[model samples]
Target: MKRGWWLALVTTLSSLVVSNGAAADQSITALAPFEVFADGFRDLRGIAIDASGNVFVADREAGTVTRIAPNRTRAVVASGLQHPVGLAFDFAGRLLIAEEKANRVVRVEANGGRTPIILNVTRPRWHAVHENGTVFVSTQRLTRDTDRDGDDDRDSDDESDGAEIILALTPSGQLRLFADGFKGLQGLALNHTGRCDLQDPDSERRERRHARCGRTDEPVQEARGARTRQAGGSLPHG
Candidate 1:
């Protein structure tokens, strides 16, 4: 998916102008010739901006989460991570990361300490945090074999044997299966109405789907829409 190019484009765009009108009449205009915000990143998988305007980026290859301050100073806030691909902030302002290779999600402390929050996950790709301290993480389970070989193969594209689901983690540390039945679940975000939107690039019908969760943390219904680009960052709910 050319993730590197997508990350670069996201980090460089300075501004976006949207026409003030009705929902169907509004249009977006981008100011071209973007300026590079920061460089020297090996592979940027995720990005997040803190309340202080400091930009934090996860370099999966380097196993580091570097922070670029407003003054252009750079510092590694967290290191030695295992394939960190998604970044978000919890309701308490704690930095959350999805470590794909580690098969867990962790909270990055102020002193650069790592505390595992959600463990025993499989291919934790991306996640979103709700205002009430509910975390929604997307996971993918691929097929084991495709060529009739006895060995397990991870690169198999047999969707019939694969599955994708989203898990919800409450503030009390209780885990529950929130939603399922997806193809290529990549990213997640909470909309204004408190519904969680999932980006499934390989879905047969659509690219994005919004799943509304009930008070019991179960998915009530899902609505599909047109194709949309998926990114590795999430907005913190108020």
Candidate 2:
């Protein structure tokens, strides 16, 4: 049987509002937890907030993306998606969704339209958008069916050798292979200094490197026939 996940927005009064001036010094007792939105999501995977403060979430099981307004109103942004996992806002403020099962990343336009930006991604799980419009996507290697049964087996004891990788999509639509050889890569983010960090929960390691568009100070595996450089050193496992 397939497992399911749920998403809920819970907040405390102290986190909701802050005081200024004289009231700031006073200790405010946190109010009881309250749910902003309680239901209507199936297996929520990724979430992104736009400039207007609308919260967008991807429902993997439901194959839909929903937007929740600040006033707690809900709206379906896109539907019938194939295993949409990660969500981010691009430089132009368009919603970027990593459609895992579809092997593509789609952009949500302001006019409520969907456009495919990055295609042929293998098991795209999470992505982060850089300030300069570069999109970094983490993907898993395809599952192998060692047996001749013609079905992909993902049993814990199956001994599959799938590795996770990170790819960068330039603003001009060029795809570049950023990094490789990760296991169970989950979260990806970019710091203020333009350094890219990714988490591999399976390996219990956090990897970070400065990754810039069209350039790299450290070693990186580039796409196509571009020169490949080995990583400078080993990162300490967390």
Candidate 3:
């Protein structure tokens, strides 16, 4: 099963129209693409590296979280999830997951069990790391029917409540939306001073266009106009 999935993913990614600038810098100098890691993941969306260098992957299609050890041994850390994507670790060593289908973020305890950390999170895809034991999540806003089948025209505000919100979840379990109004924002990260930054393929293009006019520092806020067209989604938190 895993072999088949890996093959499919490799074929799909090879055909994807990725950003040239970002892909150019992501290559590993010492390791070839095939040798960088094992070819066993199927629809792997997000990945997180622990302080000890262990790799945690969110397998969306498999609905599981697989941990890759330094020795390259793979094991399922958590399973039975509903399309888990973004995986992050809190300050106290809790495994946090953003389950897209469930529209919530759950935490795996030290005992290897799961608990709901935050729910109804508007299709969260990426998470941002913040100081003082805070984690920020990026959620997608409900919008017009992408399928154009005239199915989602019932509630104009249904997606508004779930609209792109950057949530700051405290270690003590408190949650708050720090920012909002992004379309399909994912891949969140924070700069040294705690500002949230994300990579949106559409927004990046807009930034490049503005760079022609010498606006190098694209606005450091939510990407209210951009959306993601990628298959797998995950938040990489350091």
Q: Best by TM-score, which number?
A: 2
Question: Residue-wise lDDT of candidate 1 within 1-238, one digit each (tens)?
Answer: 2323433433452122111232236544446553346656666677766667677788877878888898989988888777788888876778898877766788876555667777666657688777677788876543333113212334322345457777777666566667777877656776655767676777644333444432334543321210111222332221
Model 3 CA deviation exceeding 4 Å by range: 1-34, 142-163, 171-173, 205-238
- For residue 150, give model 1's deviation from the true position in Å: 21
What does candidate 2's lDDT look like per residue over 20-49, in tens digits? 432346654446654324244657677766
* Candidate 3 lDDT trough over 10 residues, lowest sum: 206-215
**Ranking according to lDDT, highest score first:** 2, 1, 3
Please give the CA lDDT of all the candidate structures.
0.62, 0.64, 0.57
Give RMSD (Å) of candidate 2 vs. truth. Answer: 12.6
In candidate 1, which residue pairs get closer than 3 Å at backbone N, Cα or C atoms, i.e. clash? none
lDDT of each residue in 23-113, candidate 3, tens digit only: 4667534332433454456676777767666767787777888887889888888887767878777767778888776666777766676
Q: For candidate 3, what is the total of clashing residue pairs?
A: 2
Better structure of 2 and 3 per TM-score: 2
Candidate ordering by TM-score (highest first):
2, 1, 3
Q: State candidate 1's TM-score.
A: 0.68
TM accuracy, model 2 = 0.71
Model 1 lDDT at residue 188: 73
Candidate 3, overall lDDT?
A: 0.57
